[model samples]
Target: MGVTIAIDCMGGDHGPAVTVPAALSFLRSHADANVILVGREEAIQPLLGTAQSEFGARLKLRPASEVVTMDDPPAIAMRTKKDSSMRVVMDLVKAGEANAAVSAGNTGALMAISRFVLKTLPGVDRPAIATVLPSMRGHTYVLDLGANVDCSAEHLLQFGVMGSSLVAAIEHKERPSVGLLNIGEEAIKGNDVVKEAADLLRASGLNFYGNVEGDDIYEGTVDVVVCDGFVGNVALKTSEGLAQMLGAMLKEEFSRSLLTKLMAAVALPVLKRFKQRVDHRLYNGAPLLGLRGVVLKSHGSADVLAFSTALARAAEAASNRLIERISERMASMNEVKA
Candidate 1:
């Protein structure tokens, strides 16, 4: 069956300007997917233009009066913005009118609203943000990107289960190995919480790969990396900053001297290939796993390419029954604990 995605068209840095075009691009690429644009009618109508004629019923508009800004608090999103684009998108997913939802709005607000509206899957205490990071083995799924800052040992184990299920659904890996992110690879390392989580993972039914350091994430040491949101968020932001610095340094050095400029010209093709391989935009979508329904989050500062990439991911997850796979995995894990 084709997937229908509800998008928060007015919730992002560019609002409908970037999201509408991205939705259109996503529709064109995925012939089997439909999109519902949720935002103010007056704002979205002009940008949609001829999309109604182009996509017909495949592209729909569900008007929402309020917009949840990037600065809005989670409480405001939950209490005040009943008719917000973000909340409305979640509502659509809950009602089964859309298979999945995507938003590039306030991360906190999105999480709060989604969890409030759809609730977490059975046995899931918290919903985590699982994102794919480029790695030696193609990629690694890491969670909880920025959800629960202070996660308990049990929460880490839940992340492992969810991450494994996600990888299984998307990559069809029967047993995707999971790693617990820590300061060292040894069992003796890390605080009490991490140590406890490690023990739980080893005992859990998952394919636990033991402890992995930050470097192991890019080395593809494990199919999935589990960490608390505080650590995960810092690591993610650090990597992004490092990538930006490296790119800038390379450009500066190449343009410094005539000899270097000539060398850069000769290496332009290789550099272009390198850039394409490491393009963060290609790996833009991060699913808020453990939710009863599927909801993906795009980067708040995402461009058209990044937003479209997120749309594609949301569609794939919905059609492949990501939520069902997670539910089954959680059930098995719960049985194991019992």
Candidate 2:
């Protein structure tokens, strides 16, 4: 499906320098897309430049006077930075002027602004940050990545429904399996909240996969993994840290001596494939699901390739009607409850 995505041009660590180019790259790959670059025109336009002429009306710029910084608190951003690029992109989505919005901005601020501007879909008690992680089965989707810190049993169930809907819409999967992140595989292993959530999931008619441990996340035990933000965020960060440490260790070992250097040369091809398999850039976009519109968050330090991945994710989600899929699932869930 054709889509128009509004980008927060001044958001990430690289600002317009990275975002503008990333949007252009994405547009080249997706012939049916339109992009609006929103930021300080002086900064964005110079970067956008004559290249805009290549795409003509397909590419345009919208000006925003302010920029949201990484240190800004969510409340401060929402109450103060009214004209910030991050907020303006969200406004575009809320206004239906864009099918989706993307930003590599302050996570807390982006979530706060997006939740406030777009509101939650009907029957959605809260929004969740669903991110793709490289896994044994190609990849898997995990949610509540950092959105709701403390979710109730009912909230976990809601995440399952939203996550399942996301996989269904974006990947065209029917009856995607959903698993609750827990202490063990047994139904009785977790705390009251988790145990109750498991029961609710089992009864909710979703393709519940029972409780999965932290290791199960990378094992690709299920299509969607549901957890509260605190746990999910910890898991996400731990994975990132582990990947970085492994890279450092490998570099250290490979450069240790001539013998090791020759060994590394021999293993270079295998290492490259392994790196590609775990490359976070391939899965850079994290959709803030349950919102009224498609809103994606790119890593704050994402390079051009990673940021382009986020833009592509936003367009795919919009094209697949992610919000509509979630709404329909929620409606059916409510009907079952009734």
Candidate 3:
């Protein structure tokens, strides 16, 4: 059987409207893939419509009575929303009914519920959110994206190891180089925690490239960039805001006058290509790395294409045995220390 993915159909801002279509698109692209749509039957069924016949056995619906809202507190959602679509999707993974789970839900709630249900991998102190970001050299994998705001030097080391394994497994890169995200590239430039983390990473048997400044992330100085959640989240949000602002400014410039409009018409193709290269939708899925089972968090405002991209990522992670690879890597690291 192909990899089965459980999708939280009622989780995102757009809810079923975005998810159902995305699931359908995913099924169409991935011939061997199957999806278990987890949400209220009434809410999801209408969206599926007659397409169910087309997908047939490849698509199935699993009803979930409760829905977790974006505003729900992590603790409250974990405690009271046991039957929520997000939790149900994770439950399917735990039950071996699905290889992975995808949700465009509240990030805090998703992380809390996933940790509670799937637990952390062996030797993993905490789970980190890792995502692919556009870089000038190509792309780079960055981790600890808003998962654990307060992380220690040890945690940063673990993030490097986990991020390395993730890139190795998914990108098929051997010994992918890892860089420590810091204020400066010099060894003594950062604070005590970052300095300590850099030392640990260098000795941790990973392909550590020492400290990297903020610009190094887009320069693709390393295959993986590791940092505490606070720094990582700030970097991610800043990049997102910059992308949006640039796009808006470009649109305004293109519409300024007849001359600019003509120039835009001539450059339309190039602009389209550039947009495709940096489109956040193409990289919407951020895996909650270190979890025992595969779980991906899609952007809350994701549309069909973005949600479908997340589903594709979850399937790839499952097929590649990403969790198992991380576990084995951690075990080997422990053995080396011993």
Candidate 4:
């Protein structure tokens, strides 16, 4: 049988309008893959339409009565919202009915539910959520993006290995280079956690490239950049906000003068390509590493295209056995056993 994907259809700000369509698109593109959509039956049935006959038995809906809200506490949601789509979908992955689960709901809830249900793989201390950002040099991976706020030196070392493995899988590069996120490129920079982590990474005999500054993230100096969730989240948000602000500024500049408008028309095609290159939504979802099965967190504002892309990513992670590969690498880490 093909890899099955469990989608939290009630999640995301746009709800079924985006989630349902995205799932349908995945079904259309991936014939070998099946989608088990979890949501209220009444709400999802219409989205499937009569044309579902075309896909045959590949598309299936598993009803979930509740949805975890963005503002709800993660612990509370995990406890009380047992029937929530997020929880139910994760449970499916845990049960081996699906190879992966994707959601655009509350980040903490998704992480909490994923951990509670799927648990962590062997040799993994904690899971880190790594998001792919659009880079001038194709794409870059940033990890610990709020899945963890406080991480130990050991955890950071683990993140490096996991992130590197994930980048290799997605970027199709063998043994991708890894970097430690720091204020400066020097090894002496940052607090005790970072300094100690840097030492651990360098001595661990991994393919680490030493310290990398925040500016180097988009520069794509390395395949994966590792940091604690506190720094990673801040960097991710900063990059996202700046990209939005720059897009807005460019639009205003283009509309300012008739000559600029004409020039914009001529440059629009290339500019459009450039804009698409930097758009965060183009690389929206990131995997929550360390879980038994792949779990991708899609942005709450993600559109149909973003969710479709996430589905493709889920397939890649499943086929590549990302979690299993990380488990094997971490098990062999000399420092971990020492």
Per-prediction TM-score to the true structure, in the order listed:
0.97, 0.97, 0.97, 0.95
- Mark the regions of model 2 whose C-alpha exceeds 4 Å error after superposition: 185-188
Evaluate candidate 3 by giving its C-alpha RMSD to the native, one decimal: 1.3
**Candidate 1 — which residues are off by over 4 angstroms?**
185-188
Q: Write the per-residue lDDT of candidate 2 for residues 219-331, one digit (tens) a residue.
A: 99999999999999999999999989989999999999999999999999999998988888999999999999999999999999999999999999999989999999999
lDDT for position 257 in model 3: 100
Candidate 3 Cα lDDT to native: 0.93
Sort the candidates on TM-score, descending order: 3, 1, 2, 4
Which pairs, if any, clash in model 2? Answer: none
Candidate 1 lDDT tens digits, 1-338: 48999999997789999999999999999988899999999998999879899999998999999999878889987999999999999999999999999999999999999999999999999999999999997789999998999999999999999999999888888899999999964566799999899999999989999999999999999999999999999999999999999999999999999999999999999999999999999999899999999999999889999999999999888888899999998898788778
What is candidate 4's lDDT per residue for 1-338, written digit by digit as tens?
78899999988899888998998888888879988989988988988786479777888889999989999899999999999999999999988889999999999899889999988987787899998876668677989898778899999998998998897777778788889998863665688988899998997767899889998888888888999998999998887788788889999999999999999999989998987766666687789998888999998999999998898899889888887777777777854567
How many times do residue backbones clash in model 3? Answer: 0
The order of the candidates by lDDT, greatest first, is 1, 3, 2, 4
Q: What's the lDDT of the predicted structure labeled candidate 1?
A: 0.94
> Model 4 clash pairs?
none
lDDT of 3 by residue, 121-237 (tens): 988999999999988887899999989888889899999989998898788898999999888545658889988998899899999999888899899999999998889999999
Which runs in model 4 stand beyond 4 Å of their true positions? 185-188, 334-338
